[model samples]
Target chain A: MSQPDPLADFFAADAAPAVDRGFRMAVMEQVARRRLRVELALRSLATLLLFVGVALISPVLQRFAQLLGQDLSQVLLVMLAAGLVAYLGHFWLTRKPVLRLPHLRFF
Target chain B: MSTPPTDAALVAAARSGSDAAFARIVDRYQGPIRTFLRRLGPYTSDADDLAQETFLTGWTELRGLREPARLKSWLFSIAWRKAKGEARTMARNRQRDHDWQEIRPDCETPETERAIALHQALAQLPPDQRAAVSLCLGDGWTHADAAGVLDMPLGTVKSHVLRGRTRLVEILGVDS
Candidate 1:
């Protein structure tokens, strides 16, 4: 006897819809372009930040150290610590939320 | 003859910057993503955009996936979240707030009307419940796989599937 499958209609609706090849190509092209853009932007930003920090911030730090009669090395160390904190804060604020991925043994 | 590489192997290759491997992965999954999106909405452009966005996000984050073999579930999770976010924006613009917009079935033939009704009934379900039903009943995924994709507990996925099925029967005028 052929058994009745009641949920067959629901399953029938799950057929793979027609999607053109251009869709896949568009996705890959965008991903590649984004990877390059992000890499270049990050490189440019880091270079700019490093240049400004060293050229401008160092002289300002030297002035502050001399005026406060503090050791220049100690002032520089504090500035480095502040920079580290800023970098971390930026990362925490900008990081994309990660996906929740876990293996399913049942699959 | 060589056996096909597992998803994990392909993922590892893709992570190493192998575009070919990533392309293979895309070739394997594009249909499911597209079909899932199509079932979720009537607008072809919306489905197409979301499908592409889903893969782009997948490629961006594939390196960080905990389990490579879980690629299908992971991709579905990303798609699910993207679809939900887009739905929120659309609903906001329209000043309406239904999670799943019940699309009136528009098939021409009688044979297809029941199937379209099933799709509409499926869409009428709450988003999470519809996802559970789609992944489990529609796609024939195991409860565990559906749970993984939906990021819900196993029991919850099972419950959603059961309840979703009952609701579909009621909406489609089918006996339990």
Candidate 2:
């Protein structure tokens, strides 16, 4: 067994100091607010994407495609490459993420 | 009162959008998490706010946690980050206070007075060492667990605990 700290008894005695019920309620309220915000953001994004794809751009898209043929392909290739790199990087990061916390500095 | 559900069970329920399940998590962890934040006192001005932020992050990122069994360590990790993050916020919000260094714990008789003095001494350590001590000593976590929560190397955590523990013992002058 590892050598114990002399303060262990003190710590055990003090571990469960009183918690504020207000704090608990506040946390739950924030959780509800946050879930609502996320739902709203998703709905907004979905509407924006739907409008862009179906309502605003689809009618005039063929004219823009006609305007730049090979350049568009080059641009598409670059975009695809960037997306692939981002996906791979995210994959690499999520692997073995147990110890990867933000940098900590002591003053 | 009924025994609280295991963290893994609570986490699984919360991930399925059960607000009450997550609220139970908040109630279960609030004490130790707040105590850790308070004992790591220099880093956060409002332990309650930082603790709230930790649980809020937990609630929002429920699905991302791979192992719910490790939820205690994971939540502590979040609280550590929130504390560090709030330091930057506090630094921006107000003129930094340096008076904690000048605080001399009132030397008095009785075990309670000595305990208060010990806490004061603990608050006076460097923030990183205080964090290591708070997790390892105050909370009874292992050095490896402290290292994981604080994101320090295991060896570094051991040294921090050793130094912090020595300092606390010296300040308290407890017969060890």
Candidate 3:
């Protein structure tokens, strides 16, 4: 006859809980949120690059506009300011407080 | 009717960014992963969070997994690491606060009472020995397979299982 082992019996009888759809849904939701964050980050990087490219070429464009009797610096300044505000606002609304830079850190 | 795809096939599809394939993988492995974490000691309260982190890490690092055939052991390895990290973090927190306490598992019934006794006995063991017992004796994993998951040597795993079981039997025997 087999020996009675309570330890083995205890382990053997420990049934796993039934499959929970809620758990899967929670995980999938996290995966979707992560994908969205990556997409937003990539789009933000592209926008920043576009802004830098525009700023780099602005001096040349301003010279052309001066010859045409017009000033372009004010408009470029306004566009740059708007982009900075939008970027800061997005960062403020979405990112965790810990992710903020030291200057902007809010504990 | 079609047979379900194997874990390797699911892993390949997941690495290709198929959400459906990844969900299938989560559904397939979540039970075992969660159960293992619950048995892993002290952090049973964080079992769900730990399991979610394991799957998330698995998803992010799926492409880095060299052998698709070893997905089960790989996921278990991730679970073990996550549990260990959580334990360290909790230990640090516990030290900071003299009043720290682990969140107790629900124990309203006779069965749960017995489970609580087992958990208490298991907690008395060193962490590695507890894990060895949980993997080998509790989950019925082979010693070699458990060693692979734990990254311990075969002989060490065997020694841990033997000693852990003996200690557990002594503890539970006294309790009963």
TM-score of each: 0.68, 0.69, 0.73
From the highest DockQ down, the ranking of the candidates is 2, 1, 3
Better of 1 and 2 by lDDT: 2
Q: What stretches of model 3 exceed 4 Å from their correct place? A: A1-5, A13-15, A54-107, B92-110, B174-176
lDDT by residue for model 1 (A1-107), tens: 97665777656755664455676688889888877777777777777988988897898877877787657668778999998788777768878333332321110
Docking quality tier of model 3 = incorrect
Point out where model 1 deviates above 4 Å: A1-4, A18-20, A46-107, B90-115
* Per-residue lDDT of model 2, residues A1-107, tens digit only: 97765677667644545566787899988987776677677777777888878767765876777777988879988999998788778779886444343322110
Error of 2 at B6 (Å): 2.1
Q: Give the proportion of true interface contacts each model preserves, from 0 to 1.
A: 0.36, 0.46, 0.25
For model 2, which pairs clash? Answer: none
What digit string (tens of lDDT, one per residue) describes model 1 on residues B3-39? Answer: 9788999998888778778877887888888777766
**Docking quality band of candidate 1, CAPRI definitions:** incorrect
Candidate 3 backbone collisions, by pair? none
Candidate 2 on B1-176: residue-level lDDT in tens? 99768999998888876778877888888999988987765433377778888998887777889999999999999999988876666456433334544444476545555445555777668779989998888877999999999999999999998998888888877755
Per-residue lDDT, model 2, residue B86, is 69
Q: Which stretches of candidate 2 lie over 4 Å from their true place?
A: A1-6, A12-19, A52-107, B1-4, B42-45, B88-115
